[model samples]
Target chain A: MFQPHADRIAKPLLAAAALVCAAVLVLIIAVIISGAWPALISQDLVVFITDASWYPLEGQFGMLSMLLASLLVMMIAILLAAPMGIICAIFIAYIAPVRVQKIYRFAIALLAGMPSVVLGLWGLTVLVPLVNKWSPPGLSLLLAGIVLAVMILPTVALTSLAAFKSLPIALQQAASALGVRQHVQILKVFIPAASAAILSGMLLAMARALGETMVVLMVAGNVVQFPSGLMEPVRTLTANIALEMAYATDQHRAALFVSGLLLTAMVLVMMSFAARIKGHNDYG
Target chain B: MAEHLFQFVIWCVALLVLMVLLWLVYGLLDHGLAKLSFEFLLSEPQNAGRDGGIISILVATLLILAVTLLAALPLGLASAVWLAEFTATHHFWARKVRLALDVMAGVPSIVFGLFGYAFFGIFMGMGFSVLSGGLTLACMILPVFIRTCEIGLRGVNNSWRQGAAALGMPKIKAVWYILLPAAMPAISAGLILGIGRATAETAALMFTSGYVDRMPESVMDSGRALSVHIYDLSMNVTGGDAAAQASALLLLMIIIVLNMLAYAVTDLWLGRRLSNDLA
Candidate 1:
């Protein structure tokens, strides 16, 4: 017979541990919001969003440009990565031989696991130079977009592959039996069936691209300007935080926290939206 | 003709994805290999990071990793166990916990850095030390570890639990002896993944663990992490590319080795489990 004392101790201990895990997210939110409280109260919310200039030293903390830069880069990343990722996923799911599929999956996993810093290093040393040849400064919105696309490609591809693989085999068999061509089936049936999951994956990728710091900081040129063109250098909100958090003081520090707060809120929103789509796919 | 072209496009995209991975590895190796030496691994730096071995940085990295694992593993394991066994899938609290973990997982590393700076470095007065950085990383990686571990735990056959109950085994004992052992491969895989994440982190560690490139005498001392060192070398220091590339190579190697170890552990454990079932 089991000792009653053991259950008494183990249950509460495990519960406490779980509570601790949940508390971490709350703690992070609280700290960031509290740190950002100064800017949130002092800076006019309207002006903060409307102002394009970000001269923090001169008391100007307009983050509208950085915010736009973040969104623009993320959009570019998704635009470039989504179709390619879906295609890559389809190739893995339907075209590759079984052994080759395994190898490809492993390679994709390796890519997914690649550190952002290393990718940034590569972008800086190799990609930036190549980009610079076309444009005077290599670090541009376009460059950041490319690096971010590569960063998120694995995420999109893997999730899409899983989505495709999860399709009932009967669907494919029935399609072929009814004289539907493979490409047609993929375009008409398979992708639609997996659309929810694939869409959610892209959303997650967007969130990642939006929040990415090192790659953008290294390759986005950290220029606080509205990117008039793809080749123009721009600073993202994340890059702004990383570049200034060191010497930043008082309201400047608080302003950086506001950037962090904004990023966290955006990511949290996307994550929940993705989770909802995933939940619907699982149940509905 | 259209179908063939479509297929060709897909193939090209796949190849391009593979090429990107190869290009990254090739780029690092091409620039880094000549600089990677035993002496480089064992020595300290001279004139910033331009002329030194990565011994101090390595030590700091290891210490930070140790602190992260030490802080995270117990919490993660317990959280995973509770989620997998104690709570029903549809329970409100369980759903809330899962939601929290998911949101945490999606929060960016830079956000984590800001939180760490605010809470640990300033509020707690840990102030840019290994303890602060490691704790911050522990928080960041907790969701990953817990989710993976929970999946592994849930993947254990329901029959095993039923059989254990039929044999009059205590729940705690059964979990410790049967469930945990069966989940070791997954737990270790999660561990390795978390290690890779923690070690490769730059933004989270940059302000929390600090950018001091000296020998850290204690966890309280600010020390540079390998990833941050690489960032600084490549971005800040003039003529620091050689050491930076070498450091990147080292970090990449560490990640690769950990990944291989994870695979090996999974294979070995799963192989034994298969044989046991057959027996």
Candidate 2:
């Protein structure tokens, strides 16, 4: 039972295995930065980021347009999906019978399981064409955002459902005793209590939308311009890397890595925001 | 009236989401079902994936999954075991490690593709081969497996561990003999979920695995995966729609089956645990 020698080796082996998990994050950022070094060395970071014209061939490596496009789509998608996802979560959690709830949960999991490429294909063949008759050349920021909303709906719904479910049963009972209707109980008690988690869930989904590549690459038209309207095509940081990484060389290749660096940066920032809100909820 | 109206609206949104999901599955089936045949499943593609079946890519996908599991499973389980059994819940470094895993989970698959390109494809001189793709996939899925296994380990009742200790059992033996067997169902579910993720992934394999539509003779050889084949056909190949849809349908079917299995196993585990608790 008291095998000191075996314990010595076993502890370090397990510790090293755990350390590998931590080391991976460090290695990923280091690799990305080294790959992006050439682009970062040549340009002023602010001007490079703020300039809207991204002519990589002509040495103008600005990503303002794509950055804006990523932001615009993320904002619109969250705005569209959050309320619906929360409502659906409420339905599954409260309104549905146990059997029906199981079906709804399975359906959402299936939706979540659908690969991004297949979802992109669906967007291209179905949503884009449908959007085209009303708007010329259906592939646009709006289309991408809509597809993104669909992709992220289950994440938001499932997270929010957990948040809603975590509320103390006494809170619901007390509200009911005070003659609060079911909707009023949800609106006044559950929503208020779960707002932080719901917001954090939405932001987590936003982070996902920002990093998502295939759907936007297929439907966002990959145009390197600021989206003037919903109908206009736009590019994203992810799409920029995916489109150019194949044939790009030297500085151009580094520039694509820089776009990747920017994308990672943006997603990390969004995730930190989500973590902060979630942390606050855990403590308070 | 207002309360009823609010309830009605929630129901409508829920139904609408379900309908949209159904429509997508239907569209994929309708577009690809007619073309699906055993020949399509077993034969190699012709004319750059525009004319024939998806045999090579399907084989490549399975190979990649096998390789990913080989690398990820042991490392992930060891890490999860360390976190759950060796350390206290609030241990400082353990918390930091957990945070890092969480952050890694949020990093996009595309970035992992870039990492594979840099670290494995170029630096390691693997050069867009299945080995590079599989290693990158291992990194991407390690976080998922660790999270699941850690939760599973935590869900084991403390009484079992206490009983082991009271019997003067060695720590490693106790974990290996008692805890791990109990957690196998959940860990197996995690493995299935990891397979599903690897199967669905497109961006991560884009640069790491070469997009050649042939069977890989070795781990060093470049190959096409079903997900990547779908992307390549739809975007680059003219008249590739039918082939792409076929590939998508196959990918969809595999993912659905894996996910359903994971759900079923998890439910079974939970039911058993609940009954045990009552007893």
Candidate 3:
């Protein structure tokens, strides 16, 4: 804490910290590309995407089932989170008193940092057992979906909060001034204006849900085939990689990396898509 | 008439949405409440589905948590201080660079695991030890540290900065001596939250820190953090029957303690001063 020579030391230390953060980022991207590129460039992309069978023993490696399961989880998660997240944001932005809003928002910030393992444990001991009681055996996509919805809620809600705050409050007031009812003002004005942020939030939720590992791995039941319906248990791209990586060797490990490689490419595309939506908001 | 009906519909929607959050809390707590026990805390993993303790995982988890927090705090604060005080806001590139951190936050945890595996585990040849894993975990948690610290540091009033400046202190001194102390409570709040995140991270550690079921002998000893142990136990189902509940309870109890310590330190610090107005 002493500063006799603080100026000289502090500046360089701060610069060095920033440099390490940069190095880590570059390091992460470099590792992913290097690990995955061997599979990406060598194999034909279409056969990987279109073929449903992922049998290592038969020398066939297809990612369709895993991707389908992750997508299914994403679809279900967003279905549950988006509506609630949007509504909660609207309530905080338009309806709640300042004190209440502050409390709610703080609670949400805490939830955002909550560990996935905790949530999965909550699901395993809580939701999975609940589902198990109703069916002969439990563990299904519906259960996983319900768990993930709550998981992604904070991201979507916070993003929607930003969107609602940035919308034209003056226009909202004018609408109310003209006897455009509060709900009418919201539905007609707020939702449309805030769509960009809402969509970005949804995209982010998809990225997270698709990539989520422990929760899905613990609760997803790890069934290898494509899910016939929402209630059937299935394995996701991420969970498959995590579950099998320890035992997987040679082709098995590389195949898993190929899945990771595919997932990384998918997420990169979604991230850029979200960025484009964010950029469009500035011009619009 | 339609507007009135719409308002009713919207309010009902709000109530339903809020109730779902309540249900989630209920689900988490009610199931957890019955199984909470101290015996669970003192045991180690055994036959799948049978009763046992996870003391090793718990110790390693706490050790990694401590290491990551101790390592990340100073760097995080320095970055926040540089951004909120030292740098000019008008630089568009500077703003973009800050925004890039948030984008980094968007990257998946599993992706981070890959990064950690490649760089720390493979490239650096740290070989899946706590040092490599903890460092990787710290990096993953850094975006969180940055965002939380920014929230706290930015909350400091401008008058406080100027008043320190008016007292004939050097500009850096004004920040170091005056503003930082004032911002301390807020930054501590963020630090607590970041530490909590670091403790609970599994994906990032999985790739870097391979599971070692022994006590962490040193920073370099590879160990499985608690979350990964929970995942490992729950999925494989090798342990004995009663142990699952005990293990769950133990994991829950450790996390609850982690949360309380984090909350208590921040709450106490803020209660004496800013009351978390910064966040």
Best by lDDT: 1
Clashing pairs in 1: B45-B52
Query: For candidate 1, lDDT tens digit of each residue in A209-228?
Result: 99999999998999999879
Q: Model 2, stretches more than 4 Å misplaced?
A: A1-4, A280-284
Of 1 and 2, the candidate ranking higher by TM-score:
2
Model 2: clashing residue pairs? none
- Superposition error at B132 for model 2 (Å): 0.4
Taking every candidate in turn, the Cα RMSD to the unseen true structure, in Å, is: 2.0, 1.6, 4.4
Q: What is the lDDT of residue A129 in candidate 1?
A: 88
- Supply candidate 2's per-residue lDDT for B278: 77
Per-residue alpha-carbon lDDT of model 3 for A142-258, expressed as tens digits? Answer: 788878888898889889999888887688878878997777778898899889878988898888888788788777788888889877889888888777776676666667777
Where model 3 places Cα greater than 4 Å from the true spot, the runs are A1-9, A95-113, A129-137, A166-169, A279-284, B1-34, B43-52, B90-100, B159-171, B238-279
DockQ of each: 0.66, 0.67, 0.40
After TM-score superposition, the amount by which residue A52's alpha carbon in candidate 1 deviates from its true location, in angstroms, is 1.0
Model 1 regions more than 4 Å off = A1-3, A280-284, B266-279
Model 2 over residues B36-149: C-alpha lDDT tens digits? 889899999999888889989988888888889999998999999999988877787788888888889988999999999999999999998999999999999998899999
Highest TM-score, which number?
2
